[model samples]
Target: MDKFIETINWCSLRDIGFVGPRFTWLYRKSDGSQIRERLDGALVTSDWLNRFPSAKLFHLSSSASDHSPLSLRLVPKPRSRMAGKLFRFESMWLKEPRCAEIVQEAWGEGLREASSDVLGKCLESGDRNTRFFHAKASARYSKNLISGLMDAREVWQEEDSKVEEIVVDYYQTLFTSSNPSDFVELLQAVNPR
Candidate 1:
């Protein structure tokens, strides 16, 4: 068991956390003694998580088995009914000469630069409309505020220190890559003066 855990840590595989019952397995004895344990989970690498940020794992109920089944949903639930429509590929678009250019421009630096310039202009004129800018800033601050978070035990953490700790831990785990080898290679590639 220890070796298995060590190997999992060594490979940097993390559990793509699930929603539903806390325990996946339930054992009940005839003497009225019952034990519940979370023995099943979906382990995934950081790259898979990055590619599918909206992926979800759900613990489905079981009638015959001791362990509940896990359902993995790659696509997230749509916010609106219209958003749930299935996507269809248009073959005619392949025949368009400018299709490739349009696609490249959509993902290219040109759009990014334009958006940055707009934001820069807004900030430059922010002094002229101080109240408007202040209101916008206040609204963003309120929207981004972290009031509370749920802990590993599924308990809500509302205290200032606890909330801060949870937020920091979450970001740390999210940003930390599963593979350390890439970091080493990246560091070696940089020329130190």
Candidate 2:
């Protein structure tokens, strides 16, 4: 048993994790003291971990078997999430007495430049506005603030969800090709007859 333990330790294998309830194994003694331990689980090597970094384990309710049967899966990599709806700050927060104090404290500490990139971007967008000038000494801005927004892009495609599926399918084939010739062939094949 000791040599077997050493061999497992030396192999550098790690147990896959589980979510939900903690214990997996249970035993009861004649005197009524119960024993519970995570006796059943799967382990993987470094190579397996790198290949399936998002792998997970789940604990299930015991039927006839004392220990939970485990499952393993390697999921396809997910695409980058589209920027969704804007989150609005609550007006009630400003009404509270502590609001001023909290704001002053946060302001005193000063936000890091890296943390305020989005805010800086919105502020800097002022320069992107087109300026119009007339020969008669009139300076007016001709910026259409709503241009290039989602509603404009979505007009080209009736189904918004299909756009991502199309993009993902297109890129997956191109990127997964191992050879240049294969990529070129795949690209040519994508065009309709």
Candidate 3:
């Protein structure tokens, strides 16, 4: 065991670029001689460390397994034209008198007796009310916009082009006013250069 530890320590010093918190792992055995030794290790090339400025290895406490898990947090490289933040609706918007009325009216009859045009109008008004409500609600919640954008970007990447286009169009409709110039300007303002 001593020889093994020495070999690992030497190899780690030579190969692992970043020497983090010395203690890496713990050990427990049913045997009378309970030994706690660093069982888990992390090794990264110098170039990899340089590439990921925020990268770090964390030795977590052992739960069920004898070996502790090593967590790596890497700072993603900057990208051009990141996704715009999603518009989050606030709960308070439901408290607004007009928004409350629109929601109540739209869902009142449950769209059973209404004609196609009536249903369409109700949906449009309901959508507008919901959007307004959420905007006000989001202000209070103070949700992280960057994280939301990152998640949306991931989804967009996995989707087909047509699906991605539809999502973009939907967001445009939800976030921008009816004015074309205003919409374009708003999009440019949110998108990265």
- In terms of lDDT, model 1 sits at 0.66
Ranking by TM-score: 1, 2, 3
- Cα lDDT of model 2 by residue, 7-98, tens digit: 77798676656643578887879999988888777777656665665555656667777676665545633434436633434343444445
lDDT of each model, Cα atoms only? 0.66, 0.52, 0.49
RMSD (Å) of each candidate, 1 decimal? 19.3, 24.6, 23.9
> Which tens-of-lDDT digit does each residue in 1-193 have in candidate 1?
9999999989868777776778999999999899999999988776676566557677878999999999887874333324453333344344445556655774684553333333344455554654445445444543444444678777756567787788889899999878764577788899989
lDDT of 1 at 102: 57
The reply for model 1, stretches above 4 Å from the true place, is 77-193
> What is the TM-score (0 to 1) of candidate 1?
0.42
Clashing residue pairs found in predicted model 3: 89-134, 90-134, 90-137
TM-scores of all predicted structures? 0.42, 0.37, 0.28
